[model samples]
Target: MASFLGDHELVKTLLSSGALPNIQNYEGNSPVFASANFSNNKILKLLLDNGGDPNLLLTQEYVYNSPLMIAAINENIEGVRLLLEAGADCNYRNQLGNSARKIGEASLNLELKALLMACDNPT
Candidate 1:
């Protein structure tokens, strides 16, 4: 809930106490994945730095949204960048066969599309 609330201090406190950053609730929404939809990247960064898996999926029925997808769909560019830098799978598609790259393209976010493209052709 700290992540959803964007409470950075509380999130850090919990992580410091050995809370699993990847632990998802019954909704299949982990702190890491849920943070992607937030307006800020602070919680996402903290979680990622504390061993949160950027590629963790929201396992809701007929849905599979990775942190990258959540970020992309919500237009959280920084969150998307953080997830990408953390080695998120750009090719991963949800149940609807939608990918972050596709979301970027569909949403007309050039920078997002560029980022995904860059990952596809790393130096």
Candidate 2:
């Protein structure tokens, strides 16, 4: 997958070729999800700009797989920023009832936790 590889050009080519931005892999992970998990902010933005859902949830068994969740759990600041700016729900909880903020706090990423909180209640 281009997202996993951080191949911006390949992703652009695929999208131009009509590949669905929201297409999921066998694990139910979309390109946006892959980009976020890998901290590929450029690719994530590409997908989002092409109609990818920042808040799209994967139907996996126990994984909380939204873009914001993935980015926060991975301590990916840029990915988190992009998703938040794209209107991702910072308060959205997954199957474990863990929001991005909770995950960041659990991981001891205080900056990420603070960022999520700020994005959740921007003024």
Candidate 3:
């Protein structure tokens, strides 16, 4: 709920109350994963800091399932950067075998594409 609503206060309360950040819905959308669909970098960071698995792919049929992929699709560059800096597998493929780079390419955001490219071959 907090993640979906981008309610940082509630998220902090839940985390303090021992809520598991990795808990997912029936559709395999974890709080962290759900947060990635939006540009709420703070929420995503909170989840990640609370032990959310950045690499948890969505198991829903036909869903991209990866946080990084979702971030790319949403054109959430900051979200993508946060996930990558937190150790998300940039090379991780989704249900369609598309990596974050491929997803970003499809988004047509040259900056995002460049970011992924740089990540794939960091200098």
Instruction: Highest lDDT: give the candidate number.
Output: 1
What residue pairs are clashing in model 2? none
lDDT of 2 by residue, 26-118 (tens): 778888888998888889999999988898877667565688988887899999988888889887877777888777667677788779777
Candidate 3 per-residue C-alpha lDDT over 1-123 given as tens digits, one digit per residue, 9 for 90 to 100: 789998988998999999999987888778888889877789899989989888888877866568988888888989999899888887777656788877766657888988887775232
Q: How would you encode candidate 1's per-residue C-alpha lDDT over 7-91 as one tens digit per residue? A: 9999999999999999999989889987888755988888999899988999988588888988888888898889988889888
> Candidate 1 has which clashing residue pairs, if any?
none
The C-alpha stretches of model 2 lying farther than 4 A from their native spots are 121-123
**What lDDT, from 0 to 1, does candidate 3 have?**
0.83
Deviation from native of the Cα of residue 103 in model 1, angstroms: 1.2
* Clash list (residue pairs), candidate 3: 58-65
TM-score of 3: 0.89
Model 1 TM-score, all chains together: 0.92
lDDT of 3 at 35: 89
Error of 1 at 28 (Å): 0.5
lDDT per model vs. reference: 0.85, 0.84, 0.83
| Ranking of predictions according to lDDT | 1, 2, 3
Error of 2 at 68 (Å): 0.7
Off by over 4 Å in 3: 62-64, 121-123
